[model samples]
Each structure stands twice: as C-alpha cells, then as structure tokens.
Target: MLVYSDDYLEVIHRPASSSCILVTFNEMEMQANGSRFWGQRFCEKADFAALGFISRRPNWFPAASIEKAAAATAAILRQASERILYGHSQGGYAALRYRLLLNADVAIAFCPQLSIDPAAVPFDGRFTRHFAPALHADMEIMPEHAAGRAYVFYDPFHAVDRMHAEWIAEKQRETRLLPVHMTGHGTVRAFAGTARGLALIESCRADDVPGLRALARSVRTGAAMRPYQVALTAIARHPAWADRLSARFGNGFSSVERVNFLYHRANRHIRDGELATARDLLVEAMALQPNNLGPARRLQELDARIVRTSRT
Candidate 1:
C-alpha cells in the first residue's frame, strides 16, 4: 500500500500480522529505476510488516525534509509495538538521520556516512558529487537524531568508513560500532541474503547484544567477503601466490577484485626490489582499470626510480 508519495520520496507499506514493523530506507539507485523499496523480498519472506522509504532521486531523502516525511506517516508508525529502522550506505544515513523523527526503537545502519556535505566531512569525497546545497545543507547525522539504540556496521580497515563509524560512536553514546572487517564499503553485502544475516537481524530486533556478538564472531569466518580478503592478503604478501590463486579460482573474482589483487601484488614486488616484475603487474592492473589513478601514479613513480637507478 502506498502510504505517501511526493516528488522526492515514496512510502510504501507491506502489512503483516506481526506487532513489529521495520522501516527501510532505499539506497541510492545505481541503475535509476523509477523507484525501488529496499528489503521488499526479505520483509515478505520474514512475514514482517514494513514501510519502505524510497528516494525519488539520489538526494539523500531530503526532498520534503525529515519533519514532513515523518508527519505524513506518524499515525501508522505509532501503531506498531516495535519499530526498527534499517538501510545500507545512503539509506543507512537516512535510517540514523530519521530515527528520532520516526520514533524508532532501533536503527541498523551499514557503512553509513555521517554527512556528505563537503564542509562537514571533507575527508570523504566519494559521495561529495551527489551533494547539493539545498538538499544536503543540514545533512549531518547528530547524536540527538538517534532516538534509540543504533548499531553501525562498517569495515574498520576502510579508512573513510572507519572515520565515519568512529565519529558516530564518539558523538552518540548509545550507538554501538560493530566492525565487519574486510568487506570495505560493501559491508552490507556480507550479510545480504545469508542465514547469518537473518540471524543477525533477528538478534538486533530482539535487542540481544550477546547473540549479536556471537553472530559477529561467526561472520568473521563465514562472511561472503572473506575469500576475497584472504586472496588479496595472500597476493600482497606473496606475489607468486597470485598466479596459484588465479589458476585455482579461475574467473571467480570480479574485475574490481582482480585489479585490487594485481595492484597489491605489484606493491609487494616493489617493496621486494623486483622493479621489472612490479612494472608488469602494475601494467596489468592498469589494463584492468584504465582510468584508475593509483596504478598510473605508481607506474610513473616506478619509471622515475628506474631512470635514477640507471643513471647511478
């Protein structure tokens, strides 16, 4: 059922007999599909009543403002015994940003940015292109915005995401920072459709911190990102291992992961003083991601070193 629709946002409700209700915020649409409700299938499969907040644009759900968005569905949200706000990335920001406005019992945000406003989080330029003065002027997710307990999941190894999660934890005393390492910016993907993901969600809904801790432990070994992280680490430490893994995995890695492996393996070779081997690896990495500046810059540095070495 369509509860609310506006130029900037759409609210759709999937009714169920359960007393609890999950409110989901949609992430930025990469494909520009008309409008999509996040967690639609999961909600249906779990038989949980849910309200999906869909963004009409990648404007970070600022369309009519949080006040107006909440006002539109105040009565319906108030009727639920338990209200949990959930989303990933952009949607995750909205989950925390509107927790107080929506009177949520809990907020689960995965790899959420504290703010995309350049002035607020200049360290992260990844999403700055999407920032607009009119929409993101008041984009910071403050401590007061989190009405109840909030769980922020992010990879600590990802520098930008680490900063965001740390800032959130520092500002919001009630917020729990859960590190799902090695998933990089795609931390949510580690749990998206798996049994452990479902279990983690159930634990969050029940407010079972111990269970969540146990699940977190299990995730370290079973996460979907584990294999990729392992492969990258192995490649970085032992350049010879790259060829062995490549032969074994055989097209199992995505192009991005392959590029990452090549780049890191090249770095290892450079550290080992194998300039020729590093040059070859970097060239391959550049071939994989022609526009990537990391390998390009490294290749330039390598050329300079070679020139200096020959002169010496």
Candidate 2:
C-alpha cells in the first residue's frame, strides 16, 4: 500500500499479521531510477509489517524535513507495538536520524555518516557534493534523536566510517558499534545472503548484543572486499603472490575493485622508485575507470615527479 508519496520521498506499507513493524530507508540510488523501496524483498520474506521510505535522489531524505517526514506517516507508525528502523549508507543515516521521531524500538544502521555537512564533518568530503544547505541545513545525527537502542555496523579499518561510528557511540551511550572490519565502506555487502549475514540480522532483531559481539569476533575473511585487502597486502610484501592471486581471481573482481587494485599497486611501485612501472599501472587503471579522479590525479602527479626527476 502507498502510505505517502511526494516529489522527493515515497512511503510504501506492507502490513503483516505481526505487531512489530520494520521501517526501512532507501540508500542513495546509483542510477536514480524513479523512487524505490530499499528492503522490499526482505520485508516480503519477514513476518512483520513494514514501511519502506524511498528517496527520489541522494538528497539524504531532506526532501522536506525530519518533522514533516515523521508527520506524514505518524498514523501508520503508531499502529505498531515495536518499530525497528533499518538501512545502509544514506538510508542508515535516516534510520538513526529519525529513530525518535518515528518512535522506534531499535535502529540498525550500516556505515551511516554522522553528517555530510562540511561544517560538521570536515574530515569526510566524500558526500559533500550531495550536501545542500537549503535541504540539509541541520544534518547532524545527535544523541537525542535516537530512541531505545541503535546498532551501528561499520568497518573500523575504514577511517571515515570508524570516526562516524565512534562519534555516534560517544554521543549516544546506548548505541552499540559493531566493527565489520575489512569490508570497507560497504559493510552491509559482507553479510548479504550468507549464513553469517542471517545470524547478524537475527541477532539485531533479537537485540542480542553478546551474539553480535561473538559474530564480530568470528571476523569476516570471505567478504567481497577481503580479496582487495589481501591483494593490497600481498602487493606491499610479496608482489609475486599478488600476481598469482590476480591471475586466480582477477575475473571475479568488479571494475571498481580492479581499478583500486591497480591504483594501490601503482602507489607501491612509486614507493619502490619504479616511476615508469607506476605510470604504466596507473594508465591501465585510468583505462579501466576513466571517470575516477583518484587515478587521474595520481597520473598527473606521477608525470610531474617523472619530469622533476629527469631535470635533477
């Protein structure tokens, strides 16, 4: 059922026999194909009723305001005995940001930012372009905004995500930070469809903090990002091993991962004083992902270094 629809946001309701309601928020749409509910499939599988908050763009759910967003669906939300908010990235931000407003019992956020506002989180410029002052004037996810318990799942090794998780934990004493290491910014992907992922979700639903800690302790070695981390580590120590791994699993790597692998390997070569090799690797990476500014910028820097070395 369509609960609410606007230019920027859409709310879809899936009523179940259960008293519990899981409200899901949509992540930033990579392609922006109309409005989409984030966890529709998951909701269909679950016994609980669900409300999916879909964003039209990557505006970070600032279509109107948090108050207005809440008001739009207050009647529907009020019907539920237990409300659990869940989402990843921008959606994750919404889950935490609107917890209190939605009267949620639990919020499960994956790699959610404290704020994309440059003024608030100057260290993280990744989502700055998406930040609009008119819409996101007050983008910070404060302590008081959260209700009941909030579980934040993020990669501690990912510096920006780590900082956000730490800040959220520090501000909200009840918020639990579960570090899913080596998954990078895409921590949610590590547990998607796997037995471990099911266990993590069940633990969150049950509010089992000890189980979550134990699951975290098991660690993630087979995650999608683990290969990239392993490849990068191998590149730094055993170049031959890196080459062998690439030969074995290169086909499985996504274009983004391939580009990243090449970029990091180039950096390793530059550190080893192999500028020409670094340039070749970077050129290959550029060919793979031309739109990526990191490799393009590095290529320019490498050329400048090459020129300076020649002059010297």
Best by TM-score: 2
What lDDT score belongs to each candidate, Candidate 1 first? Answer: 0.81, 0.82
Estimate TM-scores for all models: 0.83, 0.90
Tell me which residue pairs clash in candidate 2: none
Predictions: Cα RMSD each: 3.2, 2.5
- Cα deviation at 230, candidate 2, in Å, is 3.3
Error of 1 at 104 (Å): 0.8
Give the per-residue lDDT digits (tens) of candidate 2, residues 90-126: 9999999888889888899999998899999988998
TM-score of model 1 relative to the true fold? 0.83
Best by lDDT: 2
